[model samples]
Target chain A: MSTPTETDAFEVDDSSIERMRFYGRLFLGACIVATLVGIVALIALVFDVVVEAWGWLTWEFLTHPPSYLAEHYDPSNYGDLPTGPGGIYPAIVGSIYLIAMTAVFTLVLGVGAAIYLEEYARDTKLTSFIEANIANLAGVPSIVYGLLGLALFVRAMGAGSSLLAGALTLTLLILPIVIVQTQEALRAVPDSMRQASYGTGATKWQTIRNVVLPEAIPGIMTGIILSLSRAIGETAPIIMVGAATSMFAPPNLTDPTGSFAAMPMQIFEWAKAPEDDFQHIAAAGIIVLLTVLLLMNAVAIYIRNKYDR
Target chain B: MTANGPQTVTTSESDGATSDDAMTDDAPLGSPRVDDAVIESRDLDVYYGDDQALHGINMDIPERKVTALIGPSGCGKSTFLRSINRMNDLIDIARVEGDLYFHGKNVYDEDVDPVALRRKIGMVFQKPNPFPKSIFDNVAYGLRVQGKDDGDVEEKVRTALERAALLDEVEDQLDSSGLDLSGGQQQRLCIARAIAPDPEVILMDEPASALDPVATSKIEDLVEELAEEYTVVIVTHNMQQAARISDKTAVFLTGGHLVEFDDTNKIFENPESDRVEDYITGKFG
Candidate 1:
């Protein structure tokens, strides 16, 4: 195709544009390859876990509390011999309670902080410093958060070996994710929408409540789902907060101050018990955890698509 | 004719003696032959940070009349229009120095409430910005914002739509999203929204610039009809639009000077300023 004479005034030579197109395609290919690599690893891991654990997953296995099969508690010999398997009911209940409590605290705290930062805070030096610290805090290791929970919630708060401490630990570990995503959600709302509201004589809070909040809700919800998934999967923080691997005497689900066992801790204990049946139960537990993560991600994607319209 | 039996300007020779009025200049522009001037500015200056936008603007906008401000790009025409209703207050760096008197009250006074003031003086922006709501809701926004839930909301919305010439087109689909309407229809919906609150002064900032030729003509006619009720001030780059619809025209030239303010016929037919004549004649590069 030939270019029009009139277009010559505005259009640049095609060579540079062609070069940019080539680079764009190259970059797109590279990104797809990276994504496929991650996907392949995930698929292989899930397949292996499913094949190994499918037979062990049963109503009975899920309903009964796990117990040791060996005659004695020999740490060295346990790994070499076969151990009988029980259920993961207590661990599942404990995780659900922990995650539920974490969501309640983290959602309220994160969304409120995000709103203040995005809407009310002025672009001053102190605000920038606080923002920089929050970004840095998000990158800190989950283990550090575990230590913090142990120091603050477990010991100082006098909630020894309790679900409350584990919940608080998970909440802290995921709070930064929630805040960052919520802030981005609020920021994605165009300034024009706010201006239109103001032009109609609406006050600052009125505009935010009426226009900005409605538009930002879906994004904030997506953030919550993603953060909660991560919280549910955390093990170190729960362990540091005094979550027990073997809750010999299981506590009630609502017992915030009693000892708890999460899926990770239960699975970790079972897989190390030398019994083939315990290893099968561990694989089954992994499959259940992965399914929960997948479901949460799906829900997040659904919310994002609904809001994008 | 002005409402109070005298326009902001006076008869050529006799009333020129009145030197107390700050806006009254020595060079006679013309007698504002109308009844009353609803809004008047005296030595009004506008600034965006350190940059001076408009300088020494003095004019009386006659009540229920169309006064158009025309200028080249960056010549402060839009700035002047925004200043009338204190819309410039939205900009952080924008500052107004001189007095803008509306119905003998200075809006810039410390005691004046800007939100209340905005309700009385509505505005329509250049691009149509209808809310992402239903057509009925968009028209009802102005009233709803004020918590006016009187049973007559339906009647008020209908009347506003009728006045804006959008009722016939959108009456059947009041529940449909405002964004679903055509460009021209959305703009008319905006007009209905602005007029729903029953403001006395309505400012249009190139309200028809984004539409097609047919839509532009329709808006021009709507503007002329609007001037019969509310005081209308419009800023436009289209010279013919200013000439066709306006009662009085203020010619803002380069260097932020309003070179001429006179009857539209006089300005278009026989302008007094050399620069205004050059601009009207398309002599500028």
Candidate 2:
């Protein structure tokens, strides 16, 4: 009923301080050790990749196309391939086409699904069922997606060995990731932002388009970048959809069936060959792939930092 | 703390039976009720799922006046305030019962478009949430989205910023990102963005609760000034703030019931209910 007197206020406690210090040391030491291990592993991985691939990189190597039968460098001795260095010209083009188409399709379907789930879907049995399936799909192996692409696009749809099949499969592979990231981005926007828009008499869609999406742009971009990088590095699914090893040129969208090889499948094929020359060539291809991946990842990091405020 | 619930204690002393007797005696020459109040509610109730959050409530919010809604946490003061603008419709499980009128038109009417309604009534949130854009862009967002290109958007942005009392601090840095400002400046920037649409009313939910004393006072002063041009409704937990800045105050209690509504002076000095008296007197919330 009464305030504490001076005598009561002066009572001190010392026993708990030592225990708190002990816990603090334990937690801090664990964090420091974990961070150090992660840094060391990343550095070692980069060193290994650079050392193995350094010899395969050269101006001619990047600009030239692959030759058959491990013969002499003379063009007259080989199967008269395209003018460029066994340059991954076709693979590079295919990768870009594959990634762009995948991104567009995924963005529409993934973001749409996220908005529907977040704004309209109540926590009903149907919504819960869909959510559980999405989380599980994110965990499904990339190779499985490749097989699905092979069956659905290559066989049933009869779009075998084409960029279209590759893109459609990649879209399926990344759809769950895009949806999850978009949902997280949408959720991070403060409820107050939505309230402010609604208070202004903004309609649900208007509020989302005007206020909610603007605030969520940085997050959405981050998700897009991450998903795109993943799509670029993917090799199994494209091979499943039949990216061939011998295609010397890029294919148009409407052209019928044709085998198209990507950088990863080429690298994998060359790496497994018996000849040392092919091994070095595959290592160079790996180097180029790594460079593209690095650039894409850097872009992702830049976007996240640019709008992180 | 005082053993009596704060609202009950405050209201008991402020109005109690004496003021009611006094009010009843004035029935023959009763106070004139303004028919054109900006927001009118009758038997308004709100529920979150099966839980009833707000009980029946009736009140008329006069136009161009600073009306303050005060209550303890979870008392549904914000809920009632949000209902005026139909902001509760955004919440998935939130359901409202009863009629809410804005300019004599029921906002819940099937024909009413909430988006159009929102364009006419802007809002500032408790914490400053400026779009991650330049100061000019943040201010021009509302107008630009509404297809308003009446002239130079820059000039209009400047006017809105000036009205929010933020221009002097930010005019030189219109291109700078809104996040670069200090907390108070950012809050004002949000206010500028809210007013850019020339909204008829502005709803502010605890706009000053997150600021320091100086920033809080600045916001209070801004609210007083804004009342001259727009119907300003603010919800605050700070009783002193309500007493200081608002012309009218509505006191709310537990479970979202409005206990009393009157002139600020009357609510603080002579409230009509024991619950309101207890609340303002620093007893239990």
Candidate 3:
């Protein structure tokens, strides 16, 4: 038998190897370009908003309520802050109230629903139908949910154009998203953990409370916070639920029926004003909204880092 | 022991009700019973949906001894082990039939709560699955679940860790996460967790198969030591490991059949069935 040469035993086609390398580089280049497109657009938008907001954005702008004569408003009469049109203070307060209420409702209802579906409910046709509907609801138009809130909460339920109606509306808009994301979080928990808990003779509830939920909490919190950030920036739903564009006082948290003004609605009003100064004020409002969003995302990331094992 | 029918007949003649009551009241560990058998299965069958996994498995697992079930993959050795503790009930499609009796009481009876049954019969799995908690919490979990960890939990946890032969390595860092430990240490931690409840029986399904040779030997030694107090029912794919540790060995072949069960020395040296001898010689699985 003839022995093969070493080169013949281990041969490489240089041209083919070079061609493969070229294709890999081309794919990597395309991916980089795709990523850069999103980053560049976001930077450009933020830069423009900050430049426009530079003169209008002030400490007083954050502390005073909206006014029709905001362009000529003076800061010397700080005692008359409620009547002053120097800032979007009431709108900021309204946004905080709205999100706080939304957070409590979503955490209770969304997390509860997710736990039931993931842990207790069997894979029956009815459950599948509900799961499918939730997925579809997440993709439904925000304006449609606005219409839902208008008809269900604002009119039929007698909540009127109040903070209660607006909060409930925002909750309805983001509830499906929260539920879907929370279920994903729960599903990400390893099945082996459940088995380990059960092997120790833990009942279903004990397993969930002690092992499953604690492990899934980080993911769940991240999902809920992200969904709330989206809800905070929502304009169309609050509009349909009748949030005021401008208000003299902050929202009355004690009374659900009191009128409120959210940042997005306030910005929308300013952006639509005849004077270009109000347009800059709208840009300032956008800056504040973006800051709040960034802060919320930071909290989400911190929670994920702290609890992830 | 060679004939299965006579053993079942004689065991059934005894009054089951009184024995069951006595078994429940007695402490699971170090109990002296009239009968030597801790678990007995009569014509036990298991199925996953339409496909059967175990067929008419009959065996009497002796008390306070290591009983090893040896079989190839898909031969239902693990299935039989899970059936002993009713762990297979977790699978939605899996079903059990006939009788699996623990201390003379049929575990499948309507009145039998699987949660309570599992407290008496703890299990370890093919992989070391320590919870993402501190070592102390992981060991204390079984007791805490049963609301039995009132004050002596720390002492019980320490004793369990010592029994599993992991205390020396992990004692200084008892508050550290169990996941931070090595694979062998994690498996030992899992063994500690299972035995923390002071169960009468410990079911292990390929417990050391995932570990290295050193870890495997450690687990083997630990299993032998555990058998002195707890009845260790182990399922292993390694033939030599079964021969080295088990008091009695049950050979399960393909198609979920229990071909032969006898003393470990007899099964390895002079088995009756031709297939059993062929399997022992590594001719076929």
Candidates ranked by DockQ, best first? 3, 2, 1
In CAPRI terms, model 1 is classed as acceptable
Candidate 3 residue-wise lDDT at B265:
90
lDDT, model 3, position B269: 90
Number of the candidate with higher DockQ, 2 or 3: 3
Alpha-carbon DockQ of candidate 2: 0.37
Per-model TM-score on C-alpha atoms:
0.83, 0.83, 0.91
Q: What tens-digit string does per-residue lDDT give for candidate 3 at A1-309?
A: 156678666455667889999999999999999999999999999999999888778788898878887554344455565555478899999999999999998899999999999898988899999999999999989989999999999999999998889888888888998899889989988898999989989999999999999989999999999999999999999999889987878999999898999999999998998887787888989999999999999999999999975
Q: For candidate 1, give the DockQ.
A: 0.35
Error of 1 at A255 (Å): 5.5
**Clash pairs (backbone) in predicted model 3:** A67-A85
**Cα deviation in Å at residue B87, candidate 2?**
0.5
Alpha-carbon local distance difference test for all models: 0.80, 0.77, 0.87
Worst 10 residues of 1 chain A by lDDT: A70-79
lDDT of 1 by residue, A1-309 (tens): 265587586576678899999999999999999999999998999889999887667765666566665222222343354542356778877777777888889888999899999998866789888888888889989989999999998889998878888888888888888888999999999876766666666677777887788889999999998999988888778767878887754566556788988888887777788866666678888887787778888999998898776
In model 2, which runs have C-alpha deviations exceeding 4 angstroms? A1-56, A73-87, A253-257, B1-36
